[model samples]
Target: MPLGTIVRLLGKQSQMGYLDEVYNSVEDLSSDYFQTKACKAMLLKPLNAASSHCHRLKINIDDTKPREVYVCKDTSCYAHCAFSSVPDTLCKCGKVMEYAGDRPENDAKTAAAGSDNGVFVIGSQKFITTDDLQIGNVKIKVLQTRINSAVLYAEVGHDFVDLVFGLLSVPLGCVTKALSQRLSKGCIDNLYRSIAGSAEGCMGPDYKRMLLAPELAPFFGSGASQILEAAESAPKKIKVDSRFSCFKIGGFSNLGRCREQAYRYNSSYGCNRHEFTYCQNTTKTAEICELDPKLHGVQNSNCDAYVKQGPQSFMVTDDLHVRPLTLDSSLRVVSEGKVQMKDLVEKEVALTKLQIMELQRAALMTCEALSSVLLPPKKKKKNLKHLMY
Candidate 1:
């Protein structure tokens, strides 16, 4: 088991007040304790909803597109006029809206809100002070408007009650459903699709139908086909030289000594390999290579690339095996060697190669072996015994 897992298990036991009995033989530990992150996400689910309950509505007025402030034409209601682009639409008060003018200054009596740019004036005369707008089955009334720089803001009727209900009334299941709807209809997940669809066929029909040109041929235009045909008809010769390391539209060329030869090739040849790095020819420094967004995007990066393989797949299977020592065995051998070294150093002994071999044969000897190597030889004790005889 991992050390993190052991720590988490002990934490759980302490939380349950079962620390004493946690090490019992048959503790009822759930299989969840052993599960991974993906498994936990699949199993555990939230039951109660939790939210900040803060949602604001702001109306931004475009100054450049001046003559199109939207207002309802119904003379009865004065509270529902909004600055919308859609000129012809039914207002929340069921009145037809039309383009009033550049500013809503004409209806001064309905001018409830004022800003530095202009003022917000209501269009309806009959309905003043209160008008309700239905947003997701919640009929919120317009209370008053406030100036917010270039934008105008309004507080909904019963705003406190609505916030309280948003926190208490909605369950977790409903919250999940609302989140799914928000993701799908909020123009977030499908925003890229909408943008891609809008830009379809923007490069014209001929470019869309064009095929990839052969190497050493005109990549586009009328001469592309002719150039490709000539290269096929005649045995086109391709010179391979180690001098130039990069390829370009004008054939192979050297971009001098630079690590970003690929970027230089794209800039000179008008290739879309590294779009972000193109047109940035101040100084071909290493910083430009790091700034390329293609390295972090869908395009494959030559600079930083990552490849992953499973641990089992990389395990050694041949006779060239790795043998690792256990912690206890290594510690024991190190401790013994340190003791033997300390004894020899204290005796201040020096031994010849032959005496060193003899010490090894004695299997780590005492101070006697060191004294024998260090002391001078005794003057023939056996000769003294022969003279006495």
Candidate 2:
């Protein structure tokens, strides 16, 4: 009942010469001829309708040359190695040709081909030439998957061929399922176990016993061994007894024995020897003290009393030699000061009361003035007119 089906039926029955006439008639048919059928079906109906006239489908392959092989100049591929000619079925690096036939020598050549430099594969699907490979395409994904799989297996101590085979054996769907599985519970555990075993095999018994314990799970092998070894060899905390030596406080030797002796004797009294001098009479003395040589007296007599010239020769005071104060003196000063502060506060409260009362009165007056200015005016009732019917 559909227009395409009608056209197809007509095309099948009609003679080759009359096919075009039938096709033209179908094209002129109403747009409503078919509903819910595929547009492709309608479009192809004309092709079928005109196909009886000895027409054949022709496909053309564009005249594009294959990309030239760029042999790496690195030692990995042995580009430096001399060869008689480019091998018929293999590259100079032993990689099998793209169109190599299945032969023993070709297979052997390819198996031996790859070096540390690059990979060589036989029968790899040619999605595109190396030059034609674009950023976003299936080719890139496949290449990445292959490279990652190779690296993974290599890390686990598998040879390239074995790694490739192991990866290839895994179905893409299984890979998807593996990816979807929990990494901690499954993939990571297996990976850890494999790496641990590889390390144990390679590193010998001492490492195996110390590093690869099954109980450690994720933290097995060299990582664990390194941590344990580091911890064992780590620097220890050494307790050293540091004693404080007594510092001999004294005056400079150049200032003479009196000054040195004075500093030595009065160090306990917190006096620098050169700062004060003992005088005999009211006259100032220039005679240096026998104990403190730096102190020059105004006169040549010895005095029992000492005078300290205040800093910059300002005020003079008697030395009133006080004994060295004990640590208890510092504590008493703090305690007495606190008690004095409390007594002063108790006496000051009466004086503050009048001032506080005056402040409160000023605050109240300010608040009243502010409220009168900010408050809204009270609304008055509006009188309404009443109409009597």
How much lDDT does candidate 2 score?
0.22
Cα lDDT tens digits, model 2, 84-203, are: 101122233444323211111223432333322212111222333233222100000000111111100001111111111112111112222223222222133343343344333343
lDDT of 2 at 235: 14
Model 2 — TM-score against the truth? 0.12
lDDT agreement with native, every candidate: 0.23, 0.22
lDDT of 1: 0.23
Task: Determine which window of 10 residues in candidate 2 has minimal summed lDDT.
Answer: 135-144
Residue 218 lDDT, candidate 1, scale 0-100: 12
For candidate 1, the clash count comes to 3
List, residue by residue over 54-165, the lDDT tens digit for candidate 1.
0011442211231233444454554321323223333445444454443222333223222222221122223122122111122221111121111011112221111211
TM-scores for all predictions: 0.12, 0.12
Clashing pairs in 1: 76-126, 77-124, 78-124
